[model samples]
Target chain A: DAGVTQSPTHLIKTRGQHVTLRCSPISGHKSVSWYQQVLGQGPQFIFQYYEKEERGRGNFPDRFSARQFPNYSSELNVNALLLGDSALYLCASSLRLGGSSYNEQFFGPGTRLTVL
Target chain B: LAKTTQPISMDSYEGQEVNITCSHNNIATNDYITWYQQFPSQGPRFIIQGYKTKVTNEVASLFIPADRKSSTLSLPRVSLSDTAVYYCLVGEPLPNSGGYQKVTFGTGTKLQVIP
Candidate 1:
């Protein structure tokens, strides 16, 4: 089975613009989470959705938002983007919302966003 | 969430064992220790996870002491392809009432495997 998949492998936008990144979780997965990774840093949690509802959010500002669909696909939106927003946005999928069995997350290739 | 501290980088020759240690002095009782490996320009991949003692999988081994304040990830006979940034994360397995599993990752240790 295919692992998590992300769309628009690369994106470039100007400051103050808006951008949307997409992710399709693995088949049979029920949870999707978003993360941001800046250069030379580890991935930081952004938002997590399970069962089409927002489950968790990170320390990001109000400009960042995300939603999950019934099919377990997710979309991450960033408005009024800034140069600091330039980074790789990763999507991960898990079996459920914090399932007790390990809850291992499988990540996708990620969408590299460059804010000019 | 607990804060983790790890080395910035490490270097080792091929076919050698590489050990990365992470310190989480404030780790909670319900928090589990997990490790992830990320290559440049790619997303992180889960390596191993354990609550206490030692847990070994086909790819790596995670050792957590009785105090649970620190953990070590051991990779046996690592190859050049194993070179990557290893992140140590501490978090609870269960989600909060809002249904979000809060996880925190550290700066991670970048491993350089020389052939």
Candidate 2:
């Protein structure tokens, strides 16, 4: 099966603008998650959605939001983008196993966002 | 959520076995240990995960002690392609949902495989 896929391979926006990143999970997958990885640092969790409901959120600010579609696809939106928002936005999909603490996620190449 | 600490970097020679250790001293009973590997400009890929004892896959092995305070990721026979950042993540279950939460991916261990 194909791996997790993300869109807008690269994007450039000015400060205070808004950006939306899209992702398509693998077939039969019901869970999707987002992460932000700044240069020279590990990826930070943003949000996760399963069964079309918001499941978990990280330490991100209110400006960030996400939603999962009926088909299991997901979109991540960041409002009032700051220069600090510049990073690689990654999308990962996984088959959730009940009663387990962790899900093995397959990630996409990521959408590189640059704010000037 | 439990925080994890790993080495900033490591150097390994090709064809040699490499082991990366992660410390989660504040781990809880519900926390499960996981590992991921990532290369430049790419998203992280799951390597292995385990709650306790030993878990091995075709790609690597995860060894967690009885205390569950720490875990080690063992990669058999180093190769040039194995050079990447290895992350040790402790997954915490959300209170409302059964899904796990990703709090932070600590400064991972950068492994540089040498020829």
Off by over 4 Å in 1: B93-98
**Tens-digit per-residue lDDT, A17-55, candidate 2:** 999999999999898989999999999889988898887
Give the per-residue lDDT of model 1 (tens digit) for A1-32: 88899999999999999999999999999999
lDDT of each: 0.91, 0.90
TM-score list, all predictions: 0.96, 0.94
Q: Please report the candidate that would top TM-score against the real structure.
A: 1
Model 2 CA deviation exceeding 4 Å by range: B94-100
i-RMSD per candidate, Å? 2.0, 2.5
Q: Which lDDT tens digits does candidate 1 get at residues B1-115? A: 6899999999999999988999999987778899999999898999998999999999999999999999999999999999999999987557445356766778999999998
Each prediction's RMSD to truth: 1.3, 1.7
What is candidate 1's CA lDDT for residue A97?
74
- How many pairs in model 1 have backbone atoms within 3 A of each other, for residues 3 or more apart or on separate chains, i.e. clashes? 0
